[model samples]
Target: MNKYFNIAIVTALSVAITSFKGNAMSDLSQYVDPFIGVDGGGNVFPGPCVPFGMVKVGPDCGGKDWNAGWDRDGNIHGFSNVHVSGTGGGCKYGNVLFAPITGNLDMQDYSSPRNNEHVALGLYEVDLKRYGTSARLTALQRSAMHEYTFPASDDSKIIIDLGSFLSSHERQYLVGSEVRIISDKEIEGYTRVRGGWNIGEPYTVYFYAVFDTPSDDCGTWKSHRVEPGKREQYDTSEPTGAYFSYRTSDKQKVTVKVGISYLSTGKARMNLSEMNSWNFDEVRAACVSRWNEILNKIEVKGSDEQKKIFYTALYHSYLQPVDKTGENSKWISDEPYYDDYYCIWDTFRATHPLFTLLTPSKQVDMLRSLLDIYRYEGYAPDARSGDDNGRVQGGSNVDILFTDAYVKGLKGIDYELALEAMIKNAEVSPGDDERKEGRGGISDYNEKGFVSTKFERAGTRTMEYANCDYAIATLARGLKEKEIAQKYMERSRNWQNLWNPDVESLGFKGFVWPRYSDGSWWSENDYSVFQGGTWPDFVYETFSWELSFYVPHDVNALIEKCGGKEQFTRRLDTYFSHEKWDQRWYMGLFQISNEPGFLTPTLYNYVGRPDKTAEVVRKTLKERYNTTKEGIPGNDDSGSMSSWYVFHALGFYPNTGQDLYLISSPTFEEAVIHLENGRDLSIKAKKASDKNIYVQSVKLNGEPLDACSFKHTDIANGGTLEFVMGSKPSKWGTVGVENQL
Candidate 1:
């Protein structure tokens, strides 16, 4: 764990009903790391936007290469309120942050040489000659919490420059508010924009802004400032900067709050009213309250620091997929319908599943949105629902996710409609050439059936099979198509093709058999091999070592093939005790850094050596997920990685995305989940941690728990789990793999 970052307790438990933040903590605005989404990498943007929001506050430092927020060389561009770092589409709104020393507005006083502009927690200081101001910014969510001790100058005030709206969805109307005493906060107005691939309905946004100190031109209405030669049509006054009166003082303290909503101005006003003034104490209290309450939903008991890491990461995981459409269900993207976030094609995997635990309403809306996409576009959203679908991030992901949710009991989606979408999706693979009766793509179903990775294609293997099974199984279960389900079940076993019989491992040599056109083949070689450098030690010419252990549905099959339980036990030992191969591919070998490998921990159950699984679970949870830039190994793919940590920490993982959680190793000694239903799943782990990875014994509901698969039924009913843990595996739970088979 890096000492630079501290793990602080969340403080309270209150949902943000009236306001985004309830009580103890600050507003969602406070905890948001604007820089998180910076092109620093991936879709990460280091802007002022709330997590995953389009309203990013950073510099105009020219695209990504020039850098943002900080980079103040002559490369130093002006600041903008809305921008995306590592992403698509043009920028929308940009409200520049500046300290004005009463002047004719200067734009080029900054330097060609980048200098001190280091941003961090509670601090955002910079030396800028451009605006003839040395500025610093800070925040606590509801309140901007700024103490910008600008250099002593003549009459001056920080400018809330509405240079541009991040795609016109931004509304900047000047309103009069006397801070704590004012009633109306926003300038009764809104801006409109469209989103999504085919261009769905446009959205109108209303926003209310609050300032800490009383302003001179309080009530007078001001129009939005537009730059010359601008094309978008709008009724607005030319100048965009909002001016307030104040004399430059040493370390002057000021606060600001921005309330945004897709509803009418009334709703936006309500948001401001609910969160009045820039009261740090009040807002922080509210946010903290909401956090604590939701956090308590799954109460975690462990070292304060570890708890912080878990909660913080968990917090980040749920930051987006926000309730943007409002209660009535209407939303617009900067790019309009063509890029509406409502589409489920992308979120199903990492996004939707994580939300299933806390934000079901949002999940409902998402499903409805997918339904809308199909109704309007004549197609259920798949991999790339935008300008092109062939842009394969893998389309089957959505189908698999739909099946996962349907089986898990989410209501709202039309069964028939869902079936049609799912079946149509399955019948067609993303890139297939030949078509069949049921299959949607060009290739016949046989060629794509579960087979060797060389045949099915590695990246396309797991999900294709998963979705095929999903289509058949969902059809069977929803309408009793058992034979179809059986067919898919057989198809799902295609993962077996990747399993090499001779080497007794997942893939021995031609793991690269199906190879690709880029010559990149099946394995990763160098650091830049994959995006984000393979998420920790995920880099594998073949597969991350930890990932190779995955075979969730048929661990016993793997165990039997590896030789009996004792021999399988030896192989397991070899896995846990092995070192990196020194080759570029085997770097860090722990597959925990990858996705397909996520289910590896639960594999121990099929083999009968549950304790081994538990020990590794404990170790990985401790070592791999430390709080640092390197904290999580992979794309976070949304929250899959964190969810993995949370579940494993609690002692089990779902074997299927459905109502079946297989008991696995746990980290926390005592973890309790306060389900929304008033039921509580309490886990008591005695002697658990880095040293105590093995379980000496286990007891669920006080019964002699012999085997290791815990059902969702047992957990949802809410009960106690007690595991006597130690550093060494207990012989009692050491059932060999081969014998079980």
Candidate 2:
């Protein structure tokens, strides 16, 4: 960034920070702004969506029929259903149709700014300044508590529209309504929405409504087709538009109890039966209890701000990876019935990995969910996946996850069942993952073989042979998968074929010498490798460099290719120094921001430069992670990025699928990890601060030790790693696996 940009960001952030000094305590909800980046970056909606649920139940951003929460002038807009307030990609979600607007169920009423544009977690209340009315609603997972305060005119009516969900309109409308009045205070109705992707079959949903105390009401049900062109005809809004409503009486202060059902209208009525009275205390208590149970997983006794960020972040991490609250396994995949909200590529790395730690049991259940998806459709669930058939987007990260889990020793629920899922993921033939959309051609060497990028023809070959390569090698060498392992291990070394000498590493290069791979030349025509470049044209989302030479299985071979330990160490030094490296591209060690580069910080030990590993770990933690908005250095692929922080901060990394990590460095004076299993792991480093960056010596349980990393087994067995600090690096540790290439 330039000096001017830096100065402005600091000035803006400084003012914001100075004003947030009131309460600095941890309670999960306080630290969350939910609006910080929701304005423009990616209309990622920030709402009360629970961990693992499919629906993104939050404040509607990207506006609905011109209604948005954040105005360019920083004013708040109306709170609509199906909100993706703010996220990276600029996209919108379901609106109107099913969104029943109470008082003035007309989109034009919310065309301009009004006073009632505000939101709250667990509860959201906003006023329609123009209409002189207000609406407030809270939820308890399945049920909602609503209170709308409006003008005393008897013409006011609460619209009950079963077809509204964000932006579904006009020609796309397909709703089957069966409305019935149960009592003056209650009504049960069903709205079946028929649409797919953009327009498909009608999916059914039921609504159960209950009024506060009682009300004089006889109801008639009607279906309305949306006019997609209603894109803010209020003379102010444009393509930014979406809204829906059902008109009903507008009594002064009316209370409502609304319940939605996916089964039938009768089911929605049953929901009303289960929740009759307007029990504010009961609803609030119920919501709190659910949050407490999920939040209690990894408790932090830190400052208020830390707790908020931690828990809320933990909240973000847990959201959308699995089906925490669903029917059947309480989680369902699209392949079974074809649905929305499945970004497997984005969630696989960190999200699923993090889920393993928070809900271990859920892992098997998730696997079963995948298996069930397979049973239903012959393939594991891809994004809108068809189990074993059809091409999907990106690599099979689930494959690597399977191995990583087994190696980490996280097992139980159903080992056999889990293995079945793993086998299917590996064996599922590759067709088109990482299509690169309209782009084409080959990527750099590092881009090939990566599970996600089967974009180009060769890219597919690289992925096709990668897992069998790892599983085979790991089976024979690491996991002891002798017979079947060797076949796969040999294939795993395919990464070596793409290796070249010019840039000194593996790159995606076509044979014929004139072409290249990893460090070689890449065809600009190959858009498949555009995002994550193969060897020569390495292009990675976090950066091409990180992924360019990421071959975790062959560090020793890399040493030989680079010349020797000294040359290899010199390269390591370049990554940390962050300067003075010859380059055409320099995106911070390239893929340092993604999972491919996660293991990079620990490779120093393999080249006899343990001190470098320590330095990177320290710098990375302080630079990338903090108590601020920009704290997340990269897309938090679930928890892998954060999990990377957790593991590295403690001073080591899981090096290979061995699940064992080499101790490189420490970031704290003292830290303790209370394991889910009875035992606790403690880590302490002395003289470990800004200037004191080297490990003078390390001791395990007071006994002097060698090397910078430790094995997971050793820690799991219950032990501590103590370190002595110094201004210079120490090289007396184990001769170790100096060059496993």
Candidate 3:
């Protein structure tokens, strides 16, 4: 093992051991079901991966649902070493594929119908019925170990397909590939591919593979021709791979270890040192142990079903924004490097904040990574993968993520550089590739104070830009950049510039209307409240009614603009009523499935209707989420949906880019958050049950909490947050309503 990897492993093991010693080590990984969202639009990858590890070794179905590559029903095409979990849209990764075969090597008919499939925290197993082979997969940080039990066959073979990747429904195209057989038992190669969700630049994935048993015959193949004597293969667009044929007895097990890196095949070979021995069980055990360490950070008292849902959500939340600390081949950075932000627009709402609270150290590393990317890449990403940034959604949501870490006082980040990045995002236009990074329509947004109708998703852009400005303003004020703070704070209210009071929706007087550069509103004929199309729509992925509720930093103003508390409260109620739900667009006014509506259920807290917030939150939790293959209501969005569940289940929700957490009902009787600062924040709900979902009273640190909100400072050092729950709504937080914002 390399010294650096050894040190990292030792440090990680020491931390896990210490945490195990500090707390009672329950087998928490048992509650995590990796398959919960594999079939649903959740698009979750059901595979073996350590928390935030680079290698997600899983099965690919080769279907259009290739986002995570595997669906519950499709045939197992192959097992690939990298995948994104719980993300939607175009797919990326799924590189370095390996498939076991028998008899004639017909690539076209090589896929097998899987049977006896199983998945857990760090293990995935399936029986490939066609080949009568049982494949078991496990992983460490950067490598994967596959154990395949093959039936008696002289032509038992393993194909390492360099050209194979998760494609379909996206624009993934292979740029080039090179494979060299090192020996009968080893091979080294790399694949250069471009275009996925991000429309990313061609990124090379280098890999090294080794087998425990040597093959009798090994050669290379391109497209349809298999060259028996050729030891190497290089190709641009044609399918290219290497095959090793072996004689095997019935139930003979063959183990293959593969390591991947973005830097080089040498680094990929070094990553194999993560698993020093060929003990697949040891790696699986270590992976389980690491998962236990993460899942144990927050212990909860609930039913097995609830625990399954909660812990699985927690598991999914840690699966992405992968920890590629020393693997950045793009630029030299000692600051921790991470990628597959997969887009911060989805995660900034809850996932990043959850990190700020539970895993502050990792959160700090991620923040540093963001700043470092800004340092080298000119812009911090809204969505990024393959060491490049692109496919920005809304404004630069990284501004919100950074401000969130700032307000919560996460350390080890250069706040000055962070502010500079935020300023650049606000002031600079991305020009041609604005869809990929930074803000689109920045000229009109800055000059006219609103994203004009000329821009697609203009209304949504205007609102998100306002939120990003608010985030910038918040961080600037804290850093004593008073003039910059004042400028952005005033600019933060520019969402109001898009508010056309004459435009009514669902009997509500005001909605954010798309405005032209000349400051004229788009005619009612030109737009619809349910402008539900994506990319080219007036709003992105949601209706104007939904985006209208998205003014998070200034909800008081939003409530006032919607005709005060009473009318606003009724509007929110009507949103959740489901009367206007349209299957054609998934157009429920309050879309629990999507991120835009994530905070709407809790908006009643702003109106001093904590009871209403509790009711809506609990209802959404009960109805929209469960522990099943199709459990998640929508795409998990790189754990964004799961983190939403994690927060609401624990009885609080974060207002991203702010220090505040809005109070709600708890599903568990007790939830203990083990903070990185060596303190435990315990949330206890008296009579917390399905029936008793309303908060009757609350106390923080034994003192009465009059409002339905609390700052991060209140729990940063850890304390008990006690809630008295009852079936009936009480005026517990109604009196101190002004404290919400």
TM-score of each: 0.68, 0.70, 0.96
lDDT of 3 by residue, 568-606 (tens): 988887777756666432424678778999888778988
Over 4 Å off, model 1 = 1-152, 155-255, 261-274, 327-392, 410-415, 429-447, 450-458, 461-464, 471-475, 496-512, 515-551, 554-588, 732-741
lDDT of 3: 0.87
Give Cα-based local distance difference scores for all models: 0.45, 0.46, 0.87
Model 3: runs farther than 4 Å from truth? 1-24, 235-237, 582-588, 736-741
The TM-score leader among the candidates is 3
Query: Compared with the true structure, what per-residue lDDT tens digits does model 2 show for residues 1-741?
Result: 011223433343233221111322123444433332233222323444434433333333234331222343432334333333222222233432222233434543323234544433343555555556666555554456666665655445554444344442322243445555566566665544443222333544556666764543334433333343132111111121222222344445666766655655555555445444464434433443345445554443445554444454555555444342233222354422322323344454445555554455565456555556555544454443101122233344444555555666665434444445545555544234333111123233234433222333343334324533474345344444466566556556665554434332232232211133333444445432224432333332433334434566666765666667777676666555554233222333433444556667777787667777777777776566555434555444333455566556556666544555677666566755544454556677787666677887888866777755555556654577787777777764535443322
Best by lDDT: 3
Give the CA lDDT, 0 to 100, for residue 63 in model 1: 33
Minimum summed lDDT over a 10-residue window in model 2 is located at 231-240
How many residue pairs clash in each candidate at the backbone level?
79, 109, 1
